[model samples]
Target chain A: MDKVLRDKKAICVFVLPAFLFFFAMVIIPIFMSGYYSLLDWNGMSKGIFVGLRNYIDLFTSYNNEFAKSLGNSLILAGLSVFIQLPISLTLALILARGIKGEKFYRTVYFIPVIISTVVIGQLWSKVYHYEYGIVNMFLRNFGLENLVRDWLGDKGTALICVFIVIVWQYIGYHMLLMYSSAKSIPEDLYEAAKIDGASELTTAFKITIPLMKPILNVCVTYAIVGSLKTFDLIWVLTGGGPLKSTEVPSTLMYNTIFFKNQFGYGSAMALFIVIECLVLTVVVQKIFKSESYL
Target chain B: MKRISKKLLCLFAALSLTLSIGGCKTTDGTDGGTTSPDGGSKDKPTLKIWHITASDAEGNRTILLNAIKEAEEKFNVKIEETGTENEQYKTKIKSAMAGNSGPDIFFTWAAGFSQPFVDGGKVLNLDPYIGAVKDKLLTGITDNFTYDGKVYGVPYQMQVGPLFCNTELFEKYNVKIPETYEELLTAVKVFKENGVTPLICGAKDVWPAMWYYDVLALRTAGSQLCNDALAGKASFESQEFIDAAKKLVELTEAGAFGPNTMSVSWDNANVDFAQGKGAMLFNGNWVTGNVNAESSAVKGKIVARKFPLIEGGKGTATEYFGGAGDGYMINSATKDPKLAADVLFFLCEKLAFDMYEQNTGLPGWNVSVDESKINPLTKEISDMTKDSTGWTLWWDVFLEGAAADTHKNLVVQLMAGEITPEKFGQEMQKLNAK
Candidate 1:
C-alpha cells in the first residue's frame, strides 16, 4: 500500500485533472483578459489594437476615475487590517479563553459569515435608510435629534457607513479562523506559564500568538485581498454613487464594461486589479516571513 | 490489495476523462441543434422576446404580457418571453447579442441606445416592414428609431416630462400653480416657509435627477442647441448650457427639493409625493398611473402641467423634453427576420392601445382614445403634449455610451453641490472630446 501511494504516476494522474480544471477556469480567462486589455473593443465588434493606450488613459485621464477607485480600495484594505482584524482577533482571544456560553458566543459570532452578502447589503441599506432607518430613529428617540444625518446619502458619511457594514459582515469569518487555531494550542504550555507566575495576557502574547503566526498571516492576506475585490455589498447599497464617493475598482470595472460598453478599458482595469492583489499578497508574505525569522 | 486499488484509481481517471469528453460533445450537439435552420420538430418557428418590465410593474407588465399572448395567436408562431428589470435587461440583451444568441425580438430605448446595436449590424432594419404599418404609427414617432434614414425599430409609446403638483398641498400652503420660472421660485419659497418640501426628487437613482436638468436644458437652451451639444457640433461649455445648469442650481439653493433627496429612491419619492409630503414632482407622465393607482393616497388630488418657462429664454413651455424612446426591435440574426418584424409591428400596435387604455403611457401610435377611461391628470398631459412645438429626447438616452454615463454622473454631482455649473459644463465637454 505504501509503495502504491508513493507512485509518481498516481500523483500525476490525480493532479492532472485539477490542473486542467484550473487551467480552463482561471489561467485561460486571465490571459484572455490580458490580451483584450490592449484593444479598443465594445464587446460587439472587431477589436482595434491600441497598445497600452487604455492603461495610460486609466491613469492619466481625469474622467476615468480609476485612480480614485484604487485609492478607495486601498483605504478599505487599510481599514480592514488596522480596524476589522483587531476587533476579530480580540473577540477570538476572548472566546478562546474558557468562558460561560462559549459555544453560544462562537455560533453567534459566526452567523454573519454564513449569511448571503446581498441579504446583508439589503439589511444594512434598510438600517441606513434616511426617513425611517432604525439608526436615525434610535438617535431621535434618545433626544439626540441633532446627530441624525442621512447615513447613505451624504457623501461625507456614505463610505464610512458602507465600511461599517462590510466590517460587521466579515468580522465573524476572521474570528472563527483565529478561534479554531487558538483552540488547537497545547494546554501544558499555559499550565507551565501559570506555574511560572505568567499572567493570562502574558501567556497569550508570548506563547499562543507566536504559535498562531501562520494562521494570522493567512487571515491578514484574506482580509486585504477581500477588501480589494469587494463589490456586491457596495453595488447594492450605494452603487458607487452619492456622487461616486464610494467608487471601488470592481464596481468601476463592472460599470465600464456593462453600462458604458468600454470592454477594453474595463479589461485594463481588471488586469490592474489582478496584478495589485498578486503584488500585495507577495509583499504580505515577505513581511510575515521576515518577522518570523527575526 | 495494492494492485486492486491501483487498478481502481486508473479506472476512475479514465472514466472521468471519458465523461468530460462526452459532456463537451453533447453541449456542442445541442448548440448546433438550436442554431440549425430546421432543428425544431414542430411546424411553427419559435420566437423569443425579451423585455424590461418587472412582473409587479402593474399596468406595464399586463400590457406586455397581453401583447405577447395576442401576437402568438395572430402570428401562428410559438412565442417565448423573458422579462428582466430595466438596468439588468440592458446588460443582458447586449451580452446575449454579443454572443450571437439573443432573442428574436427585444425591447430597447430609441436613438443613441439603439444606435450601437444598429451599427454593429445586430438590429434588423424595419423600413421594409414600416411601409405596411406606417399609417397606424404616430407621425414622426419612427424618426427616433431611424439611423441614416433607415428605421430599425417600432415605437411603442410616447413619454413626456410633466410637473405633477399635489393640489391639496398647494391649497394648504395657499400657493397657486406656477406658470413661469419666477412664479415657481415664489411657490418654492412659500412651500419652504410652510415647512413643506417643494420638490420630491429621487437623486439616488441619478436618472430621476437628470429629468430636472433635461427640462431646464430644453427650456433654457432650446431643442436645437441641446441636439447640437449632444451630437458634438456645439460645446457643452456654451453659454446656454451654463445658464441651464445655473437655473437648476438656483432652484437647489432655494430649497426646492427635499433635504434627503439624494438618498431617497424613485419608489420612496413617489410615495412621499402621494402621501402629500411634497408639493411637486417633476417626472414622466407614467407617474400618473401610480398616483391614480387604487392604493395611492394622492388619487384625484394631483394636477399635471408643463414646466414653467424660463424668463427671457428663447424657448417656450411648448418645447418638451420627451418622445417615443422605449420600443421593440427585431434581431438581424433571426431565422426569419420578416416574421420577427411582423410580430414586432403587430405587438407594438396592440401594445400602444393597451398602454393608453391601461393609462400606462401616451400611445406612440395614433388610435381613437376612450377619453373617459384615462385619469384627468393624464388627459391634461395628453392635451398639453398635443400643442408641444418641439420635443427632445432625454439627455441620457440621446447621448451614447461614456458620454451618457458622464452626463448622469455629472448631474448627480451637480445636484449634490460637489461641482459648480462651470465644472459640469467642462466635464460634459470632456466627454464629447473623448
Candidate 2:
C-alpha cells in the first residue's frame, strides 16, 4: 500500500479526474472566450473573425464605457479592503475576547453570509427606496428633510449606496474567518501579555493581529476578488442604472452579450475582467508574502 | 501513508458514485414521462411553448393558458408551457434559440427585436400558416413582424403608449386635460404650483424614460424621420431629432416628473399614479390594467389619451408611439413546424378575444367585444387609437443591437441632465454609425 501511494502513476491516477473536471469547466471556457473575443458574432450566427477589433473597440470606443466599469470595480475592491475588512476585524476581535453571548453574536453576524444575495439585494433596494424607504423616512423623522435624497437614484450617491450594502452583506463572512483564526490562538499568549500589563487593544494589535496574519491575508484576497466579481446584488438593486452610474464589468457584459447581441465585444469585456482579477490577486499575494518576510 | 491512501481512495470512490447516481437520477426522472412502448398507437407530441406573460392576475398569462388548454383538447396533443418575467424571458429565449434548443413556439416583440432571429434563419416564415387567419387580423398589423415580404410571427395584441391621467387629481387641482404641448407645460406648472408631481415616470429601468423621448421624437420629427433614423438612413443629429431632445429637456426642467423619477421603478411609478400621488403617467397601455385592477386607488377615475401634439411639429395629434408589438413565432428548428404553427394560430386567435374582454390590451386580431365588459380606460384607449394617423414602435424595440442600448442609455443621460440635446444627438449618430 505504501509503495502504491508513493508511485507517480498512482498520483497521476488520483489527480487526473479532478484535473479533467477543472480543465473542462475552467480552462476550456476561458480559451473559448479568448477565441470568441476576436469575432464579430451575435450569439446566434456564424462568427466573422475581426482579429482583436473587439478588444480595440473595448478600450478605444467612446461608447463602450469599459474603462468606467473597470474603475467602478476597482473602487468597490478598494472599499472592501479599506472599509469592509476593518469593521470585520474589529467585530472578530471583540467577539474573540469571549464577551457575553459570544456564540449568539457570532451566529447573528454570520447570518447575512448564509442568506441569498437576491433576498439581500431586494431588502436593500427597499431600504434605499426614495419616498418610503427607511433611509429617507428616518431622515424626515429627525426633521432633516433637506438631507433626504434618492440614495439609489442620484448619480452621485448610487454607487456609494450600492457599495455600502455590498460591504454590509459580506461583513459577516470576513468576520467569521477572522474569529475562527483568533480562536485558534493560544490563551497563554494573552496571559503572557496580561502579566506584562499590556492593554486589550495593545495585545490585540501586538499579538492577535500578528498571529492571525495568514488568515487575514486569505480574507483580504477573498474580499478583493469577491468585490471585483460582484454581480447578483448589483444586478437586482440598480441593474447598473440611474444613468449607468453603477455599471460594472459583469452587468455590462450581460447587457452587451444578451440584450445588444454583441457577443464578441462582451467576450472581450469578460476576458479583461478575468485578467484584471488574476493580476490583482497575484499582486495581493506578493504584497502579503513581502509583509510576512518583514 | 497506507492509511491515508486508503481513506483518500474511499472518499474518491464515494464522490464518483454519488455523482454518477445523481446524473442517472436526473436522466431517469426526465425519461420516465414519455417512454411508452406501444408502437402501434401514435404517441402525442409535446408542444413546448415559452412566453413572457407570466404575471398571474392580469397580463396575457391567463389568456395564453386558456388558449393552450383549448388547443391541447382540440389538437389532441400535450402542451408544455413555461412563463418567465418579461426581461428574463428575452435572455432565456435568445440563448435557447441560439443553442438550437428553444421551445417549439415562443413569444417575441416585432420588428428589430425579432429581426436577428429571422436573419439568423432561426425563425420559421409563417406565410404558409397565416393564410387561414390573415383576414382575421387588423390590416397592416402584421407589418411589424414582417421581414423581406414574409410574415415570421402572428400578432395577438396592439400596445399604444398613452398619457394616463388621474381625473380626480385634475379636478382637485382644477387643471384642464392638456390638448397640445404648450397646454401640457401649463398643466405641469399648475400641478407643480399645487405641490403635486405632474408626471411620475420611473427612469430607473431606462425604458420608461424612452416613452417620453419616443413621443417627443414622433411629434417633432414625424414617423418617417424616426424610422429613417432607426434604419441609419437619416442621422439622429438632424434638426428634428435635436428639437425633440430639447423639448424633452424642457419638460424635465419644468419638473414634469416626480422628484425621484430616476429612483422609482416602473411598477412603483404606476402605483404612485394610481394612488393619486401623481397627476399623470406616460407609459404603455399595460398601465391601464394596473390602474383598473380592483385594488387600485384611482380605478374609476383614470383616463387614457394619446400624447398631446407638440406645437409646430411635423406629427399630427393622432400620431402615436406604438404598434402591434408582442406576438408569437415558431422556432425554425422545431421537429414539428406545422404542429407548432397550428398551436400558435389557435393560441393567438383565442388570445385576441380574451385580451379584449379582459382589458389586458387591444386585440391585434379583428375580434368583436361586448363594450360594457371592457374597462373604461381600455375602451378610451381603443377609441383614441381608432383614427391614429401613424404609429411608431418603441425606439428600444425599433432599433436593433448596440444602437438600441446606446439610444436607451442616452435617453437616461439626457433625462438626468448628463448630456445636452445636441450632444445626445451626436452620440446617437456615432453609435448608429457603428
Candidate 3:
C-alpha cells in the first residue's frame, strides 16, 4: 500500500475525482461570488462593474446591518467560549471521572447535539415565548409577572435569548469532544496522582487540562466558527428582527440577497463571511498553536 | 473470491459517488411526473408552471392544483408544476428567469416585483392572449400588470387592506366600531382599558405593519400625495407624511397593536384575532377566509369596513388601500406561447372564481360569485368597496427591490415607536432620494 501511494500516477488517479468535485462545487462558487461582488446586479437586470463599491457599502450602508451583525456573532462567540465551553469542560471532567450513571449522563447530554437544529430552534422559540413559553411561565408562577416580556421579540432580550439557545444546543457537542479527550488520559497518570495524594481538582487543573489543550483548541475554533455561521436557529427564531437587534451576518446576507435583491452587495457580504471565518479560524489556531504540542 | 468482492465494492463506491454528484444538477421540473403512456399523448407537449405556495399549504395551493388539473385536460397537454415557498420563490424565479431556465408559466408578483423581469425582456406580452379575458376583468384590476400600455401579466387576486373588527370583542368591551378619526381614538382608548388590543398587525412579517402605515399615509396625505411621495416626485418630509408617521406612532403609543406585534407572525395574528384576542385587524381581505375557516372562533362575529377617515386629512375613505398585486406571466423563452397562454388564462379564471368563492381574495376577473354563499365578510367588504374612488397598491409592492424592503423596515420601525415620526419621515425621504 505504501509503495502504491508513493506512485504519483496512482495518487493522482485516486485523488483527481474528489479534487475536481471540490474545485467545481466549492472553489468555483466562491470565486464566482467574488466576481459577482464587484458588479451592481439585481439578479435579473444587467450588471455594471462597480468595483469595491459593494464592499464599501457592506460596511458603511446604514440599512445593510453587516457590521452590527458581525458584532452580534462575535458576542455569541465570546459567550460560547466563556460560558458554553466552561460548562462543557466541567461536565466532561465530572463524567470522565467514572462516576455512577456516567454513560447515561453522557448519552442524554449528547442527545441535543444529535437532534436537528430546526427542532431545537423551535423548541427554544416556544421556551422563550412571552405568552406560553416555559421561561415566562416559570416567572409568572413565581409571582414575577412584572418581569415577563417577549423574549424573542424585544430587541433588548432577543440577542441574548438566541445566544442562550445556540450556546445551549452545542454544549453537548463540545462536551462530548472534551469528554473523549479527557477519557483518553492514561490510567497510570490518575493512579500516580492518586498515590501522590493529589486532589481531583488539582489533577484536573495541572495534568488533565494541560493534556487536553489540543482538544480545547479544537473546541474553541469550532465554537467561534460555529457562532459566525449560526444562521438557521437565528433565522428560524427572530429572522434578525425586533429592529434587527439580533441580526447576524448570515441573516443579513440572506435578507439582502433574497428580499432586497441586491445580489452583488449580498455576494460581498458572503465573501466577507468566508474571509471572516477563515481569519478567525487562523487566529484561534495560532493562539492554541504553542500549547497544542502538549 | 474475497479479492473479487473487494474490487466490486470499490467499483460500487466510485459509481455511486459519481452518480450522486452528477445528480446534483437542478432539474427544470419537467421530467419527473408519470406520463400517460396509454393515452394519445405522443403529440402532447409539457407546460411547466411555478407558483409561490408550498405543496403543503392548503388554501391557494389547492386552488392552483385544481386549476392545473382542469387546465391539463382542457388544453390536452401534460402540466409540470413546481411549488416554492414564498420568499424563496422570489429569488428562485428571479434567478431562473435571468438564466432563461424558468418554467414556461410562472407566478409573478405584480408591480415593482415584475418590473425588472419586464424590463429584462424575460416575460411574454400577454395582451394578445388576454384580449378576450381583458374586457371581462374588473376595471383597474389590470393596471399593475400593464407596463407602457402593454400587459405583461394577468391578475387573478385582489385585496384592499380593510379594517376587520370583531363585533363580539367590541360588544364584550362595549367599544363601538370607530367610523371617524376621533371615534377611533376613543375606541382605541376604551379597548386598551378593557384589556383588548385595539389594532392588531403582525409586525413580525413587516409587510402587515407596512399596510397599517400605507393606509395611514393615504388617509393623511390622500392617494395623490401618497403616490407623488412614493414616486419620489414629492418629499416624504412634507407635513402630511410626518403627520402620517405621527398617526402610526400614535396608534402604537396608544397600544394599538399591543406589545407583542413584532413577535407574532401574520398567520399567528390571524389565528389570535380569530380566537378573539384582538378587537380589530387592519389586513387584506384574505383574512375573511381565516375568519370563516372551520376552526375560527370569530366566524359570525366579524365585520369589515373602510378604514375610518382621519380628521382634517386629505385622504378620502373612498380611496381604498389595495389593488391587484398577485399575478402570473409567461416566460418569453417558452417554446409554445399559445399553449402556455391557454393554461395561464384558464388557470387565472378558475383561480379568480375559486378565490372569490373561498373568500381567499376579491376577484380580479368579473366572476359572478354568489354573494350569500360567500363569506358575509367578503360581501360586506366588497359592498363597501363599491364606494372606492381609487385604489392604491400595497406600498411595498409599488416600490422596487431595496426601496421596497426599506419601506417595510421603516414602517416597522414607525410601528415599533422606535423612531420619532419626524425621523421616520427623514428616513423615508432618504429612501425616496434613492
Candidate 4:
C-alpha cells in the first residue's frame, strides 16, 4: 500500500481524471469568464477589450441593479441560516430520536430535493397564484378577502414568497445532513448520558450537539453557499420581477448574458459571483473553525 | 487491507469518471451531422429544425408538424424537430447559435431578435434561393428578414394590433362602447365599479405589458415617430412618448387592468379572457382565432374593435402596431445549405397558406385558400389591416435584446407605479443614448 501510494503512475491515474474534470467544468470557465469580463462583447460580434469597464458598470449602473440583487441574495442567505437551518435542525433532532413512521417521514421530506427545480417552481407558483390558488381560495372561503393579495406579484412579498418555497424545498436536505450526523454518534453515548441522569435536552445540548459540531459546520457552509448561488427557483417563479423584487445576482447575470446579449458585462457579474461565493465560503469556514469550542 | 480497499475504490471512481465522459463523447460523436459520407443513414438523412410551437398544438404547430411529415415523405429525410416554449426558445436558439451548434433550420423572430445571429454570421444568407419563393411573397414583406441587403429568414404569418372585447358584458352592463380615450375611461370606470376586470394585460410575461405601452406610444407619437425613436433617429424624451407612458399609468390607476396583471402570463391572461374574466384584451390580431377556440367561453361573442383614439395624439386609427411574424433561418454550419434552404422556403410557402386557412394569423403571402370560409373574427382583423397608414413593429421585437428587456422593465415599473412617466421616458431615452 505504501509502495502504491508512492508510485507517480498511481497518483496520476487517481488524480488526473478528477483534475481534468474540475479544470474543464470550473477552472477553465472561470479563466475564460475573467478574460471575457475585460472585453466589450455582445456574445455575437467582435469583442472590444475594455479594461475594468464592465466591472465598474456592474456596481454603478442603475439598470444593472447589482447592489439590490446582492442584498436580496444576502437576505436569502440569512434566512437560510437562521430560519431554514433551525427548522431543519429541529426536525433532524426529532427524527433522529426515532419516532413512529420515521422512515416514511424521512423519505417524504427528501422527495422535493430529488424532484426537478422547474417542477417545484411551477407547482409553488400555482400555489401562490393570484386567483384559483388554494391560499386565496381558503382566504376567500374564510371571508378574509382583504388579506388575499397577489402573493408572488407584489414587491413587498415576492422575495418572502420565493424564500418560503426555497425553505420548503431544502429543509429535508439539510435535515438529513444533520440527522445522519446525529444518528452516527454511538448508542453507548446516550446510555452513558442516561446513567449520569442527563435528560434528553441535556444530552442534546452537551453530548449530541457538541458531537455534531463538524457536520453542523458542514451544513452551515453548504446552506450559505447554496443560498448565495440560488437562481433557478427564483428565475422560474418570478423571472426577477413584478418590479425587480425577487432579482438576485445569478438571475441578473443570466438575463444580462443570455437575454441582453451583454456577454462581457455579464461575465464581469459571473466573475464577481465566483469571487463572492468563494470569499463567503472561506469566511463561513473561518467562523465555523473559530466557533469550534462552542 | 482497509487502506488497499479504499485505494481500489479511488481507482474505480477515477475509472468511472473517465468511462462516463468517454461514453458521453462516443454518443455525441456517433450522433454526427445531418448527412454522412459513408451513407449508412442516407436512406433517411436527418435534418434538424428548432421551433417555438410547443404549447399551441391547434394552430401553427400542426402546420409545422405536417410540413415536417410531408417533407419526410417527399424528400425521404428524417427531420429532428425540437419544439421549445416561447420565452425559452429565444434563449435556446441564441445560445445554440452563439456556441455554433445551432439546428439546421431554426425558427426566429424578425428584426432585432434575428440581428444577433445575422451579425454573428451564424445564419445562412438565403439570397441564393429566395428567388424561388420571391413571387409568392407579399411585396416587401421579406424586408423584416433582410439584413445588409441579404435575406436571412422568411415570414409566413403576420399580425396587427387590435382591441378585442367581450362586448356581451359591455351590453349587459349597459356600458357605452368606447371609440375615444374619454369613452374608454368611462368604460373602465363602469367595469371596475361593476366588479369585472376591465382589461387583462399579462405583465408577468413583461413583453405583453409592453403591447399596451407600444400601441399607446404608437398612437401618441405616431408610427413614423415610433419608428424613428426605435431606429435611434429620434429621442424618447419627447412629450409624446411621455404621454404614452402617462396614458398607460392612467389606465392602471383607473383600475382598467386586473389588480394582478403583474402575476399573469399571456397564456394565463388568455385563459382568463376565454373564461369571461376580462372585458377587453388589447392584444395582437391572433386573439381573433383564440377567441373562437373550442374551449373559449367568449367564442364568437367577443368582437375585435379599433383601439380608442387618444386625445392630442399624432397617431390615427390607421397607424397600427405589429406587422411582423416569426420565420425560419438556416444555420450557416448546416451540412446541406441548399437542402436546408429548399426546405425553409418550401415550408415558408406552405405555412403561409396553412396559417391563413386555420385563421392562425394574417398571412404575409397572398393565400390561395378561400377567403369567405375564414373565421369572421379573422376577417374583422384582416379588414382592420387593409387600410394601414403605417405599422410599427412590437417595441420588444423592434428593440434588440438588452434594450428590449430594458424597455419592458421600464413599462412594468411604470405599471407597478414604481416609476413615474417622466422617469420612464428619461430611462427609455437613456437606452437610445447608449
The i-RMS of every model, in angstroms, reads 2.2, 3.6, 3.0, 2.8
Off by over 4 Å in 4: A1-8, A137-146, B1-47, B69-79, B335-339
Question: CA lDDT of each candidate?
Answer: 0.86, 0.86, 0.86, 0.86
lDDT of 4 by residue, A178-247 (tens): 9999999999999999999999999888888889888888888888889888999998898888788899
DockQ of each: 0.54, 0.49, 0.53, 0.50
TM-score for chain B in model 3: 0.90
Candidate 2, B-chain TM: 0.91
Better of 3 and 4 by DockQ: 3
The 10-residue segment of model 1 chain A with minimum total lDDT is: A9-18
TM-score ranking of the models: 1, 3, 2, 4
**Candidate 1 chain B: worst 10 consecutive residues by lDDT?**
B32-41
TM-score of chain A in every predicted structure: 0.97, 0.96, 0.97, 0.96
Off by over 4 Å in 3: A1-3, A292-294, B1-40, B55-57
Tens digit per residue, CA lDDT, model 1, B1-434:
87988768785976698579668856764552133434355787888888988776566887788888888888888887888988889898888877677778889998877777887898888877779899898888987888999999888899998999999989987888998889899999999888899988988888899999888888888987888888889998988788889988999989898678877778878888888789999998888977888778989999998898887676787888899888998888788878888899898888888888777788999888789997678778999999887888898888887778879888888877889999999988987897
What is the C-alpha lDDT profile of model 3 across A1-294, one tens digit per residue?
565467675566567669768988899999999999999998887888999999899778865488889999999999999999999999999999999999999999999899998898878888987688999999999999899998888989999988898898899999999999999999999899999999999999988999999899999999999999889999888889988999999999998888888899999999999999999999988878755454
Cα lDDT for residue A274, candidate 2: 92
- Give the per-residue lDDT digits (tens) of candidate 3, residues B241-317: 89988888878888888878888878788898999889989888888878888899888999998898899999998
**Candidate 4: chain B TM-score against the reference chain B:** 0.91
Clashes of 3: 0
Over 4 Å off, model 2: A1-20, A141-143, B1-42
Reference-based TM-score of each model: 0.94, 0.93, 0.94, 0.92
